[model samples]
Structures are given as C-alpha cells and as structure tokens.
Target: MDLTRTKALPIRHGKPKVLKMLLALALLLPAGFGIPAQTSYAAGISKPFPQQVDYPGMIKPSHVTQNAMNKSVSDYYDYWKATYLKHDLSSLPGGYYVKGDITGDPEGFKALGSSEGQGYGMIITVLMAGHDPNAQNIYNGLFKTARAYKSSGNPHLMGWVVADSPKAQGHFGSATDGDLDIAYSLILAHQQWGSDGAVNYLDEARTMINDGIKVSYVTTNNRLNLGDWDAKDALNTRPSDWMLSHFRAFYEVTGDAGWIQVIDNLYSVYDQFTAAYSPTTGLVSDFVVGNPPKPAPEWYLDEFKETNQYYYNASRFPLRVVMDYAFYGDPRGKAAADKITGWIKTKANGSPANIKNGYNLKGTAIGDYATAVFVAPFISAGTADSANQAWINAGWDWMKNKREDYFSDTYNLLNLLFITGNWWVPEGQAEQPIINLALNKPAVSSSIEGSGFEADKAFDGNLMSRWASNEGSDPEWIYVDLGSVQSISGVTLKWEAAYAKQYKIQVSTDSSGTPVQWTDVNSTTDGNGGVDEIDFSPHNARYVRMLGSERGTPYGYSLYEFEVYGTSSP
Candidate 1:
C-alpha cells in the first residue's frame, strides 16, 4: 500500500493497441496524403488478439509523462515486479511465498483471516500475469509451492494449507481465503503467461472452489457459509462475492465457456443471498443465513432482524469484493457491483450527521466508503457511461465534503489513488483544476473557525468540525491553488491521528474570496480505525477546501490537515 509518485511511461491507450494489430492488413502506399503512413507493428501475429499486452515492445518509451491517468495501470503492475521478484521462495517455508503485506499474526489485523496471506498472494499473482517478466516469475514461484504442498492421489490439486500453523497462531483449517486467492491467482497467471508450471496451481484453485461449492454452499438456499455449518453457521457474504471475482478472472484468462457457467451459477447464489439487504434503511445485515433466506430476527438489530448500526467500517467490504469480481464482465457480477454501489449511495444520503471518533464501525468514516463509490463509475463507465458519470460526481462530492476525520492510516492512501486514476479524463477537458499536493510535506493542518474564535486561534473556530473524531482525531485544513482550470486527475489525504467524516470544499477564481461553486467530497470511514483517503477527477474549479463535518466526541467542528492532488489539463 506504500505510495510514491514516479514518472509515467508512454504507451498508446488500449484502443490504439488493438487498432495497431487490426490495421496490419491494409498496407498504405501513401499515394494520396503527402505524409507517409506509420507502419503496423503487429503484422505477423495470428487472428484473435490478446486484450492487453505487458510490453508490446521492450524498453519503456521516452516522453511518456507519468500522471494519474496513465499511472493507475502501471503502478499496480509495478508492485508485483518490485516485491515478488526480489523475494526468493527457496528460503521461505514450504516454498510458499507471501511477497509482503502478511503480518503473520491472525488476531492483530481484522482483515487477516485463516488463508488471508495465501489468498492475497493468489490475487496478486493473477493480476501480475496481465504484464510480462513479472508474470513468468509469479508462475514459477506458484508452481514450486504447489509441488511442495501436493498430497498423494491429489491429481486435481484440491487443497492448500494455512500459512499460520498451530504452532504459530493456532491454525483455522486446511483451506481458507488464502487457498482460494492463491488458487485463483495461479490459474490466472497460467492462462495469461501460458507457462506449463501454472497448470498445477490453476487446477488446484479450480478444484478447491468447486469443492467449496459442494460442501459449503447451501444449495436449497443458495448461500455461502463461512466454512462448515457445524463449526461456523454464519453465511458471510464477502468471501462468496470475492470467489465470484476469482471465477470471472478465470473466464477472462482461459476464455473457457465452462468458467463462465461457474460464474453464472455463483451469481445465482449471490442473487438469493443479497436479498438480505433491508429496504427501510439501506444498510446490509452484518450476518445473514436461512434456507428460505428469511429476514433478520426481531431482536437481530433492525426492523428486519439485523442491527440498524451494522459495523460502518466494513460497509465496502462486501461491495469491493463483489465489484472486483464483476469488473471482468459477468452480467450477474455487474449486478452485484451495482448493488453495492447503490447501497453506498444510500448510506451517504442517510448517514448520521455526528459520528463517534476512533475506528469502530459507527465511530468514523472509513476509507473504503469513498473507494466503493469511486469504483462504481469506473466499473460502469465502459457500459453505462451516463450512470458512471453520475456515480463519479456523487462519489467525489461525498469525499470532498467529509474526508478529514474518517481516514486514520496511510496504508489506504493507495486505494484513494486507484479511485482517482481509474476515472481520470484525458487532459484538455474544461473542468475544475485540482491543487496538486506537495508530496514532500506529506501532511498539513487546519481547524474550523468558531463564533468566538480569533484569526490567530489555531483553527479553533467550529466545535462540530468533521475532522475531530477520536479514533485518530487531530484537526487541520490545508489546500493548494491549481494555477488554472484543469481536469482533476487524482487525490490523497493523510491524518496524524483520528480519521475524518465528511467535508465541504469550494472552488473559486479567488482563493481568498467566497467560493464560486462548492462540491461535496467525503472520505471512506476506516473499518480498522486508520488513515484513509479519497480520489476523483472533477473537470471544473480553481480553489479546493476541506471542511470537517463530524467528530467522534461531542466536541464540535473537528478539523484537521488536508491534501489536494490532480494533474494540469494541458
């Protein structure tokens, strides 16, 4: 999650890449036009081209400027290259590799589950195969691990063991998120890289997913169980949704019709499970299970039987996992993605004005809220451009108005960057100019002015500032003045302590004058009570402001440091 700005490499957009391949047919004599036509680079390749290439030609191009629009895809690929390439698997236990981000302590981090490390490893590996060199390395490492973990008579490659053993943190079971994640990752890498080694991992991941279907999925009800019904009866929707993403990736890599069938079946299961969402208040149930998939019990926590205040922190948990799966182009997958995005909009509209501080679900705005909203537009833009635009505006508005008190950790800043880069408009659109943040400083402070506050009162103005929540509360506001009107490309905000809730940012021709227009930007509430960030491209404005709205404590007007990020239109 560590984010550092780096120069971008120049590569043609996706359209040009496909065009370069297709136009290989028509050789131009250039008899009509005075200028010579550029030669096609993909003349020799066979029909039915690959969707994306890691490096069509070797040696990164010169003059490619690195910015939010181009860097999103590049940076994701770079993470795998830098981390996994340098770390060798021979020294690691069982030849299994985590490639970093594994704390190894199961109880310390909430996101860390039984197979979390291996699961994350799998996803990373699959995503890596989208590029080159890195794909080869990932394929090799995964195969080595598979061979070591292979059991007798296990031709289908069904099981993967937990990274944390009984001696380490008390093992949960043989298979968990880690197995699914790794298995899926390996399959994707195999398909993309086409390395013989990848077959073992892909076969194993496919086997494990199907087995989970047989043992854990409730056929009559069409819901996914936590693991086994005897030990854990709870049917957590997040993991099931994540599995759908794995299936979608498998389909994209293999182009196998059967994989699509698997994805469709999973979506059918998801359709029945997602019925748990309450109509009265858009909050999804914390736990949902039933043969008929009945509503929550009366004492459960809401009018529907679940609690009204389900943990606010993991609100994006279900949506993000589901959307990642849907991004690969499944109809039902897209539905799941839409469901989560729609739910988030409702939460933003109905959220309590005053939130408690610190990292509790109800305490502060977690970073994922912004991400859930932000990703909606990106996922839908190719298919539903208008709906995507609306989602982008709403997501950016929510983040701009209230981000200070919600983010308490720096790790999530990377997520913010993803949101910004994904929706970025190519330069030269009439839009609000985003104030490029000074990366060297990392943080700046501000406080809201109260009725009795003096000019020099250290931002001690409003008592109800949104940035003053307790989980990581420390307030301040600071911003940048974009020299001119430019399409905003991206943004990232950091906090010294407590995360922010919501804020009001104004853009004007005059930095010190009244805002000509205002846009609402809200940050995601951190589920783990840490620093969070939001990102987007708003093609209008010159000045931006972060106005804190809620604090964890009764103390009013919590304010804190602010950040502005974007690229110039020219």
Candidate 2:
C-alpha cells in the first residue's frame, strides 16, 4: 500500500465552477419547505447560489478579517497553481498523467501509486479550469491515468494505485473514497465545462455514477462499502468514506432514491453518535459499524484506544457537513455544522489556535498539535455559523503558507477556496479571485551577511532558497512586516539541516523604539525539519518574527523559507 492509503475525508462543507444552464432564481423545495431561490449570475446558468453568513455583533473587532482571508486564499492558490498543477502533475511513461507528491525517494518512486493523485488532479483541474488555460487537457491526462488503473473485479472502479507495474503497490485493487471524489468531480466537470468537444462530460459522469458508483454501492443497507473487496456487511463501512453532500448530488443526477436514503442513514449515524458517545459536542469518529453506523465503543486506532475519536479520517466531517449547508442549506447539515463550530468554540476557547490534534468522541484532546488539516475544515463550519467568524478567520490564518503535501495541502486549499469565497458553485455561480488582497508586505530579517542566505529570500515567493543565520550566533531572527496592523494566524518555516531546534515565533505592532515591543505567539523546543507549519491565536500586529535560540546541528539556525499568513474580519 502507498504511504497515503488512508486519506482524510471531506464532508460538511463544499465544490464547483459555474455554468448557465439549469433553473435560475427558482425555488428548489424538497418534499415541503422551499429554500431561497438559487440566483444565477447574468449568464443565467443554475449552479449553486452564493450563500452568506450573518456574523453576529460587530464583525470589525475580530482579528480574522475578510482581507486576511482573501490574502490567504490568493497567496495559497498562486503558490499551488504552479506546484500542483504545472509542475507536480507530470506525464507518465504510459501516456497517462500522474500527480506525484512523494519526493526525495531512494527507489525513484517505482512502488508509488498514483490513484489518489489522479482523483485530486481531476478535481483540482476542473476547479481551476476557469483560470487555467490548459486545465481541460490536464484533466484529460489525469482521467487517462485513472482508467489505466481500472480494478479487475470492478472495471468501473479504478485500481486504488498506479505503480510502475500493474501488480505493484496494490494497483490491482480499488479504494472507496478516491473513486467517490473522482466521480463527483466528474459531475462538477460536466457542469463546469459541459458535455462537449471530444469528451462528453455528462455521459462520462453517468458512466461513473452508474457503472462505478452504482455497481459498488452496497444496496441491502443503503450505505457504501470500503471497496470492491469489502463484503458490504454491517461491520465494514468507514465513516470517513461517507460524504453526505456527494450522496445528495448523486441522487440529483441519477434520480436514485437509494442515494437519498444513504444520506439520511448517514445523518442517522450522526444522531446515534450524539446519543451514544458525544451528545452535545456531536463529534464523529474515524470508523463506524452496523447499519445506520455508530462509532466503535471499544476499538483501537494507532495510539487511540477509542477508535471512535475524531482523528485524521473523521476530521473531514466539518468540511463535508458545511458543504451541504453551503449548497443546499439543509437543516440537518446546518445542525451538523453547528456541532463542530459550537464544540470547537467552547472546547478550544473560541480560537482554533487552542484546538489540539484528534479528540475523543466525548470531546477530549488526544494530545497533538493543532494541524492545518484539522483547522481548514472548521473554516467551512464557520461559513454556516456567523458566531464562528473569528474562528473562521483563525482557521484561514492557519492556512497561510501551509506546506503543500498530499493530504494537508489538498484539504488546506479546498478549505481556503471555500472560506475565502474563491471556490465556485456550478451554473451561473460567481467566485472571488484567489489573490493577495493585502498590498506589498515586505519581508526582512535581523541581518543578512552572505550570498545565498539573503534575508528577503525566504519571502521572495519562491519555494526554494532561505535566510541562514550568521554562523556561531546563538540568537538569530527573521521577520515579515505587513505594512499595517493585520490579523495573523501563524507562520510556516521550511528548514534545512541547520534549522531551529529551539525557537520563539513572535509578533510586534511597533517596529521602532528603544526595545521593540514583541509578544511571543508560539514557541518550539522540539522543531522538526521539512515543513514546520505552526499556528497561534489570531494576533493583530504589523511585524511577525522567528527568533531562534538554538540550532539543530553545529551550524547556525537556517531556514529554507519563512512565511507569515492569516485572516481578519475586514
């Protein structure tokens, strides 16, 4: 299996690019209640209507600002537009395109599979098609790769991996989550690009929905199985695999009543969790069992004795639930979204910076750092709850300069796109641009004394290069000044061997004076090399600095790059 065999899921929040073909400004009522008429842009295509949250109180004081969110979204898209799309997505020898995230491998990525890459590639490509000129071609390439790895048992279901050989790295089998997203992305692609040219988007979506999804969906209990191999029994469903919004979309497209039942059953699972494990908090677990699945009471997950806790897999519930609200405004969806917002606000003291990694179903922290992936989805939760505005701001702040990897990067950008209002709704939908709304924010360090170790290199918007401290120095610092007092979430430090082993990330409002007033936002005595993305409570400051006290090796503290990012209510 690949290193990324178990992936975090996307739920609660939302996807899509706008098209102008469906019912525009018409009420879409399900059974009884009528929702607000979904309005389309001048194009008159009926995509998802844009939604707004009524943040209570004065939205001004919150450090999480609109401009900050915009800046975060813009900076991230620009950084990833090239890396994930242009560079990382390369053509394979088999004439299929693979998006490879694994780097610096001794075996040259031979055993690495590319199914996850194929799925995400298609999703991102379709989303970026409006801005990217070569998006369609790239999507076609990725689709080819997906087809190349077709599962033998179920032809429609793709083999979970695509390695050097057909049998290598489980390339012979399939996984449920990737295929679901890939099919859903194809549906969005149909709406975004239309069934035209050489490729018929609508027809292809139908193929995936019928041939792939229909064939694999476990019919007896109205739930999805793990994959083709799973017996689709009571004890088999992965909670992370349940994406309610995608199920709804599936119902809409296929007119299959079973899909709706699947969604209803999923919500039932949510209800069961509230009653059994976490009543008020409503936290979901990573895995579930039985029909109308409930969390495993006495199960083990890695280090967690209670496998039902919200860990890597279940962190996506917020993202998934919020999407249902963002698009359909389902009351159940709103309730689910509120569970996370209320829980985080109450548990983390109303700030995402305080939230820790993983938690028991009863709302107990599993003693881990607040990761970018965990925080990103909550931003979607904030979209449904205006009271979560500040928290949403804090979440976006955490995404700033978030290191791009297979999992966190994917979730971060999706969360960024949604929270920042850059993600679109298909058919007559409008989207804000993903760009730095914050003007020229110059980056400077305490000192620069070398050819390659320039202070500005860290913030040059380049992935490579850095600011190395003067050798023999115990205390070295680098900082970024945002021209004005802005809401900041945290900073990302990419390090080499001579990195910070002990450091203090601090901020200051006044850069001048005898002793510049600085406040420590976050500190680390055990700093890991690679991408060290750290978050803090929302801070309003003009200056952000990384003060290193000790180095990882004999050499001075060196940073491949240092980045400051966050959002504000503005």
Candidate 3:
C-alpha cells in the first residue's frame, strides 16, 4: 500500500461487541498472556515543565512575562490533547494514538494518526509532565500503540500509519522522522523518570537506536534515509531529517561514534546545498538528491510539487539546525541558522505575520499566506543570534495563542518549548552550572517601563521578568549593590528586545561616596541583543552598573536578568 494513499478503514457496527468479548477474555488470562501491563511512572518525573533552563548561549523573547509564556504552552497543550489524542479502538485498549485531521478526505477513510504524529505525541507528553497530571499515562499509551504497529521492514520500527478496521493491516513501513523522535523520547523518559520500573526506557532506547535506527534508517554513507523502505535509494534524503541534536543524543546514549559521522555528513550536505543553490537564503528543498546533493526534481517521489522548494518538510529545517547551536554550540549550525533568519528578517520587514508558508531557494516567497508551521521554525532560528532579538520577540507574539491544524499546532508547541527555555538537555548531557552572584541582590535603575517592571526585577534571576528603561531614552542605567565591596570577574546580561547598542560596565568601590567615583571596567560599542557575557579583570566594587549610551532598538534598554559572577572580598 502507498504510504500517503493509505487511509483508516471504517469501523463495523457489530465489531464493538466482538472487541469487548476479546478484551474481556484477554483480561481473564495470566499476567504475561496478552499485552504487557501498562505502567504509570508518575514518580519518575524529575525535570518537569517550566524548567526555565538557562541554556548557555541561547536567547528567548524577553518582552513577555514568564507566566504568560508558560500559560501559552499549557493552554495549547490542553486544547491539543483534548482534540487530537484518541483511544477509541477496543482492540488496543489502554493504547492511545493521535487522530489525524480529515477535513478534505474525498474517500472518507476516517484517518487514524501517522507514526510521525505518534512520535510527536510521545515527546510532547514527556516534556509536559508537571503541567499535565496524566502525562505519564498518556505517554505510556502512545508508546504501546507505537509498538503494536511495528514496521514489516524493521521489527524495531513502528509502521507509518494506523488503520481502524481490525481486518486492515496498516502501512507496515517506517518513516525516519517518526523513528528518530520516538527513540529520542524514550531517552527523555529514562531521564525524566529512571528505567527501574516496568518499562526500562534506557534499554528500549538503546535497542531502538542501535538495532532499529542504525540498522535500517542510517545509510552506509552516514546520511539518513527517508524511511526504512527508502534505504535502497541511498542518494535521496530529506533535509528535515538532518536532526543534528538528536544524533548527538543518540551518540551520547549508545556510545556510538557512527552517529557523529552522520552529523558531520549531513552538515557537509547542508553546506553543499546552500553554497550551490541557496547561498543567500540558506533555504533547503524538502528533498535533496545526488552526490553533491542538489534539490530533488519536481514529482521526484510523487509526494508533492514543492519538493524542490522550502515547503512543509523543509520548514522544520531551522528548528532542527538551531537546536544544535543552542545545545552544543556548533559554529556550523550557527552559521547556517544566521543565513536563514537574517534573510527572513529582511524579507518579512521584521514582522513575523508577513512570513510566507513556502519559499524558493533564492529567497522568493512561493506561498503567500502566513502559517505557524513556517513561522515557528524561524522563531527557533531567531535564538541563534542576538541581532534577531526583535524578530524573535515579534515571532513569539504572533504565534503564541493561534490555533491551527495538527501539523501546525504540534510544531508550534515544540518550538514554543524551545523558545521559552522549557526544553532541556537529557540528564547526563547537561551543561556545567554557573553561579550568579547578583541573583536576588538589591538593584536600582535609572527608569522603569512601569510599576511591575522595576529595577530589582533584573536581578531576580528570572527569565520571564525584566527591567526596562524609559522609552526612546538615552543615558539610562541599572546598578546592583553587592552589599559591600566584593571581587567581581564578569557579568551576564539577558537583554530584552530593547537592548543597548552601546554600554559600559562601570564599577564604584563606594556606594555613597561624595564624588560617587565610577570607573569603566568593561565597555562595548557593538552590543547585539541576546545573552551578553562580558568578563573583565577581577575588581572589588560595592556597586556595578550597566550604563547605556545608545539603544539597540527604538525603545530603551531592558534586561531580563543582569547576572554578576565573583566572590566576596576579604
């Protein structure tokens, strides 16, 4: 059966009774008789939602309150969960699946969900543990459903689609994207809760990664094939499947260096395609083919006409690429991300609403309307540089509350998690800790945006809250008192969209001296917005201030968190 053409079979009227009888008989059997007992590992949740992790080099939209950001995710998940999550099939009781949208189905197949959607559901539920009380249960049900639809080509992989009719066998082939995410989510589950329970998540992840993915999906050239069935066609590859961060995680868990080769190979392919076809925009086609890797021709796989353009599949490129830079700090990833975001910022005239759905390699908009599927990835890409801070902020505002179709909504939630700093690295792969000396310290500013955004908010160690100076102002400043003169080595400024283009880190030993002598310990004329980490020679000062000379944006300087690092003076 054609993967795309296959649809869910209609349910028969009398089948419910038969299914109920079957379920009743199965329940009466021994412990290991039928489907394994579904375990709810609620106690295993370690890192829950609202993690607000301070990713080392990534930036977030600083204008909105953190509560608002968290609400956006929670509200959307509630809607998405209610609408798409389904468990009606009695054959797979306690097994859930995401229901695919069927608005324009001519044949009325009553579509069940795809393996891709199943993968997405698993990842979303695991990440949203704290916010949703039934997250673990939902996640386990999704996992059971995925396992039931095992791929014919590879037993370790799930089939591409699920059908409703008991007689109809679903498409027992695997899509690479589904397998990749499913395996990654298992690792996250292990980290979130441990492998000691009924489900050994880590062990399952290892089997999937080593036996399922490495054996079937990964080509000999270290490039990812589109699916398990597409392994014979080694040259044809999907740009969105170049998930570098996932590959890194796979390597981390399996201790396989081959995944590293996969990462390097795909990065080279990305470089080759961009340099040859899209040097200016850094946009990739949905499908890329050949040794040098050119965009696949129209009707290449009979998927769609826009395979050669940056359509639905390639729309995910930015989110995938930017995560590598955000998590691992890969310069190549940053360089690739900058090319796409910098062009989009100019193309959209700094408005996220103006972003189109599809684009040609040369940066021309192919699709006229704006949708979250296209816009959300750009928001993720915006985090790659501080220069795109305003663009990132605008993108978040545009995408936050909008409800679209399943594909759009799911991608939007995933991107929102990354944008709001809720997405975290797995347990063992986390970055080193940084101590902020100025956290919760006494602070004062030259001006404030309003009553709530006061001077002290900048020192509260919260990413959601910020302190803003008066609009369109010059010579604004925010200072933190260390209580007494203390040795300080550096400061990190998590700036809002309204950042300082020119600023100085000035320190004074005496907080209430007659002359109020202040010396510039560090200064910069070229300050870009994101997270600025400035280090200077260790100096003992009771007061430290960021003196802004010129604003980066039209508004005044603002900071989410103005962090100081050092030890107390002797």
Winner by lDDT: 3
Q: On residues 1-570, what C-alpha lDDT tens digit does candidate 2 reach at each position?
A: 000012332221110011001211111322322223444332312232222222221122157565565555556656665565432323344334443443112133352434555666677666655345566677776776677668755778776655555443333556677788788777777776666666776667667877777777554566676667665454546666777767666655653434545666567767766678788787788777665456765433232344566776677778777776665556677887787778778888877777776788888888466666677776677678667667766665666777835566766777766664444443311122122212235767666647767777766533224567777677888877777777887676766556778999888888462228889999899985545767788988787788888877766766645666666632
Better of 2 and 3 by TM-score: 3
Clash count per candidate: 80, 29, 1
lDDT score for residue 280 of model 2: 75
Model 1 / residue 377 / CA error / Å: 10
What digit string (tens of lDDT, one per residue) describes model 3 on residues 305-362? 6779988889988999998877766677889889999899999999999988889999
TM-score for candidate 2, please give it: 0.61
Off by over 4 Å in 3: 1-42, 102-110, 167-171, 429-570
Best candidate, TM-score: 3
Ranking by TM-score: 3, 2, 1
Q: List where candidate 1 sits over 4 angstroms from the true fold.
A: 1-68, 76-96, 99-114, 130-132, 142-176, 198-202, 209-222, 228-242, 248-277, 280-283, 294-336, 346-385, 390-570
| Model 1: ten consecutive residues of lowest lDDT | 1-10
TM-score of 1: 0.42
